[model samples]
Target: MIKCIAIDDEFLALEIIENYVSKCPFLELAGTFSSPLEALPLLNECGCDLLLLDINMPEVNGMDFLSAIPNPPLVVLTTAYPQFALAGFEAGVVDYLVKPFSFERFLKAIQKAQSRLAPRPAGGTGYLFVRSAHRMIRVDLDDILMLEGKKDYVAVHTQTQVIDTLTTLTAFQDKLPVKDFVRVHRSFIVALNKINTIERNVIYMGDKKVPVGEMFREDLLRRIG
Candidate 1:
């Protein structure tokens, strides 16, 4: 079961989420909090695997609160404002639920969280399976040299070959371990250890060169340096 906590300043909102959590067989409602501040102590004490958080709260809003926590659990942001969706994803939230959302929509979000937390092959293996042409292909994380996004698909550049899959670059970025990979541009996510050299605003990964955007340059330099 996925242990979870619901935090919403609105009492009715929390009640709806709590009821929804009870209906899901795979979910266990650990606690419900109407106050974001009070929820902090309970979060550490109870220990949860998922968090149902409200993005707009008094004093400490959900987005900032999630950011402050180190290695936060899978989160689903609940907000009336749609503008916060992008920021929520950037903060690593698994999904976003606009207020007054249906149970069906809520269930779909939880399903995504389940897939994300699903157990991989045991034994310290650093690899993930990506779907391609109705078949699942195992790609070793260490073999990845860089990732290039092309519209709807992303090309995973490995040392020997490129694996093209029908997935967004942001999706791959979220799954990749942050300590080993960094997004250097809107269309490029590069492996820190596989970088051959950085000249100007370009990253050379073997024979391929990926351009680095100005916004992501500082972080990329800090990670490599």
Candidate 2:
């Protein structure tokens, strides 16, 4: 479950967030506060995974509150003002929810959070339970063709489908078996047996052409030979 704290000056807004969070199977509401300042002590104590924040708080506006933290949790900004959306992303917020958003929209934001939150550890495991929009999917290791990094999401391309799961590629680096999977580039990890060819530093997995990083190319060659 993703532990989260909600901070909004509006009591009604906080209520809605709490209600929605309670309904989701994967979320746990740690606490809620009308101001960021009031939430600070709890935020420091709990080390929550996500923050459902509002941008226009009266006490200490959400942006300022976010900047004060040296290593803030993944934040999903909830605000009535759409103008603050860009600024929120620049501040490294995971998702932005406009005020009066439907539960469906709110859930989608949580889905984004799910993608970035902890995934089940994959080492020594034959399969992984990947997070989807509505449920967790069990994917076998041999079925995986490659993993493509999509900013905060990792697209696990298999023989039949592409599963977009939460977690950065850097964070996922150590999760796979070294003998089977190799990071051919910063954005791509390919199953060694699935690659058909490597020509001019590009890897071919079926019809897909994945570029090989100069730094990782020597390792790929050594492994292939």
Candidate 3:
């Protein structure tokens, strides 16, 4: 079972999340807090596997709170603001849920997070079975060049072809091994070995140019060398 905590200043919001957590057989709700500050100590002590965070809080915002935590648990941002979605993904949040979301939507998000945190076999050939339009396609890790985000969906660009899926870039990032794939932008994640050249703010993979975000530049440079 996934140990989880919910943080939101709104009492009703917290209640809703509590109800959702109670229903999920695989989830164990460790605690709930109105203050992000109070939640920090509990998180540090217990080391929760998942966090349901609110973007808008009193003293410290959700984004700032997440930044302060070192190696935070897989976060699912529960907020009314949709604009923070991209920034949340950039901050390594597993999923973003706009307030007043249906139970089905919440389940989908949690399932995605569970899949992300699930353990894999050691030192084996890492492959992902993705369902395309009509058939399930098995994709080898070595063939993937980069993953591009287009709104809610992601396009996995491989050496042979580009496969589109109704999934978030953050979700894909969680599944890919960090040593092999690195997220260089809110919209892009590239295979480390496939990098041909780095010039200014862009990365060259043969002829294609992928722009690197300012925030991710430092990590990308360190990886390149």
> Best-fitting candidate, measured by lDDT?
3
Best-first order by lDDT: 3, 1, 2
TM-score of each: 0.70, 0.56, 0.73
The Cα error of candidate 2 at residue 115, in Å, is 1.0
Clashes of 1: 0
Report the C-alpha lDDT of model 2 over 133-202, residue by residue, as the tens digit.
8899998888999999997899999999998888876445445655677777878889999999889989
Q: What does candidate 3 score on TM? A: 0.73
lDDT of 3 by residue, 33-116 (tens): 999988878898878989999989988999888877765777899999999998888976778999999889899888877776
- Candidate 2 global CA lDDT score: 0.82
Clashing pairs in 1: none
Global lDDT scores for all candidate models: 0.82, 0.82, 0.87
Tens digits of per-residue lDDT for model 1, 1-24: 899989998999988998898899
Winner by lDDT between candidate 3 and candidate 1: 3
